[model samples]
Target: MVLEDPSNPLVLRNYAQYLESKRDFSGAEEFYFRATQADPNDGEILSRYAKLVWELHGDQTRASGYFERAAKAAPEDSNVLAAYANFLWEIDANEEEEHSSNAQVDENAVLVDLPAKDFKEEKRPSSPPLHLAMGLGIGRMDLVGINQDYIISCPDDRTTLEEYYKRVVDENPCNPLFLRNYAHFLHQSKGDLHGAEEYYSRAILADPSDGQALSLYADIVWQRHHDKDRAVVYFERAAQATPETVFIPFGFSNVLASYAKFLWEVEDEEDAIEEAKNRMPVGQGTATAANA
Candidate 1:
């Protein structure tokens, strides 16, 4: 097919996938890259290429750029969004591990003469005022938005956000949004998987219909603990709850896509995969099946 029409992105991508399945990573990378060049806007091709670069070549920078591009190219694609999110989570986990190793190295370093002031703890910035407004009759979603804004604005200073999140969740212990957000913060910022799992479980207990929380919890269970049975249960709950979660656009579709991918790739369960395909949104199931 490449000999007949080298510019055909679909053919190129298919060939790349075939090579990947055969463990010819180098050949797969070349064809995936060629496919992306042929069709720059194809999010699937871009995502595949990004995964290949990240996993095989260990080029985090290049992979991150490609993943961002893939998300931008297909914002509505659940698979693309999930893949990008997973990539980010993996990066965070890796960085946390590296930081831990570096801390150990620093602890063992030869003592050097230094000023007493150098040993002083740097004072962290004060928590943002958004949490202070909790008593002003602020809505739950409004608080969520405020927290998100603060986190985005102060990406490097998670200490403030952590304090703010802890306060908010402490006051609103039953609020699923607050609990889930706090759980996510613990997972990403504090590298506290166990803490995150506790909060995620609390979030689910607070609101059984919270699809996003369920899905996120499922991810943690699968990735962190490798508990396949528990993960499947949570994923199924997420998919079932997604339809009632009106705030999330295409929520059901996203859950279905994530569930299908989990079954197909992680578990490799044929019956579960078929069931997931049957539940997926119209054309998406066809595409997934074809790719499989």
Candidate 2:
């Protein structure tokens, strides 16, 4: 019989996921703790637990610790690193490659967002990979900052994360999911746009329809490499193929807007705006006709 509020870690984990899916990050984190204590070897719990820390507070260090656990648990899953690299880029911009320090990225740059991904539910397996891989290392990530001084004083702690992510890429080369994630991390953290471009390209070859690789590969080429022509092509492809995903729109839009801005500065304003509009309508067919 299911307990109304069972103390089982698995049950708590399910509840935590329910809270997270509802956008209640705080609730998820709290329950995730109860779950870890109940079952420290649960990989799914660790992944969500890590992501919860990242999303609610942008605590990359703690989040990274959790990611380590999650990664160890499900060595073949890309979703674990999917949020990590992106959130790492999102938080403390100065620490990421795009921004030299915590000041800003492209002083004139603004956030380019794509349409949100459609949410579809899927059934969970009784024993998922995430649940089995929670072997150990839960406490390390849970600590609120073993090095407080490093956090407040340092404007950029990119090195530590970069090393960690690099190791992830190197150690998990055999797993396509891990390889995809590692490629993604490099794209965001390595400070080598060309290298990032290569990794993302390889990831695409590994998984052609991978939304993460498609958009990130485009970002590296267009934004960092100044190749708007190729960037537009990839952005348009990513937009068309990955319309149903919430995150694709934002990444796709970033490329689109960047290309358009470049065009405006180069006296091709009309075509620039038209191209941006072309990919923005990808989800219209799937959405209700009224909204479309």
Candidate 3:
């Protein structure tokens, strides 16, 4: 039914996802290829296809090509950039492993003397290879911008990751995911407490019922600003927004834990311990409720 409109990229992409979920690699690849052909400029779709290719083929070289294409397609899209960064990180890790394995093999091999080959002057190309000199026709996005998190973590590049976060935030001001992640990046990487707080405020304002955002905001305000009163307000809000039963450990319970810690450690309230016990008891009821 979805493929009825073969021209619709969204439908094609969704079909591709369905195929991928079903573990139909070839089917998924065909659908993804069609989707990309239908909308070559869609960064999200490209990224999805890139990830599928990587998972299906387990070849970082081919996957990197797709990732580079996706990043170029959406230079300002933070998700695509992050995906590209992850791809690069994996490739680097794989290369390091290969080098380590080679070194170990070399170390175990017994030394043997061999006659040195005579040096010969071979015919060389008159000019550099055309492909080597040629640039990808697509606009060149700054490597630092696409791999901001990697750069910040490694700290090898001279450029700061602040600009990339600022650009992504500016481009996607209303996106809660982007705003919260940018806030986190600023807080962790740059130690820009004030800037992080501002972005966090925007994220919370956009979605009051977001327990994670509320908890994160509370943590930041309490830790950095040292305003326990303001922090507790957000924490209480987070607890209220939390569901009674959550399957995910990092769900509502994590937020509650944060709140409990603040109460016990900072406020020194005995109710904190009581609240934890009351909220989550060690019994089949918790498991049953989670299953339900």
Structure candidate 2, residue pairs in collision: 41-134, 44-130, 94-101, 114-249, 114-250, 116-246, 117-245, 117-246
RMSD of each: 14.0, 22.1, 19.0
lDDT of 3 at 26: 93
True-structure Cα RMSD, model 1: 14.0
Question: What TM-score does model 2 achieve against the real structure?
Answer: 0.33
| Candidate 3 overall lDDT versus native | 0.66
Using TM-score as the yardstick, the better of models 1 and 3 is: 1
Model-by-model lDDT, in order? Answer: 0.73, 0.55, 0.66
For TM-score, the strongest prediction is 1
Candidate rank order under TM-score: 1, 3, 2
Instruction: Name the regions of candidate 3 deviating beyond 4 angstroms.
Output: 105-292
Ranking by lDDT: 1, 3, 2
Task: For candidate 3, write residues 1-292 as lDDT tens digits.
Answer: 6747989999999998898889898999998989999999898888888887887788766776777677567744546656665555555567668988887745333334322322111111122122111211112223313333222323354434455456556876887766776776667767888988998899998778878779889999988877878988998788677663442424554665566566555634446756765777578557876899
Which wins on TM-score, candidate 1 or candidate 2? 1
lDDT of 1 by residue, 182-257 (tens): 8877887678899999999999999998887898899889878878889889987886677522323225545656
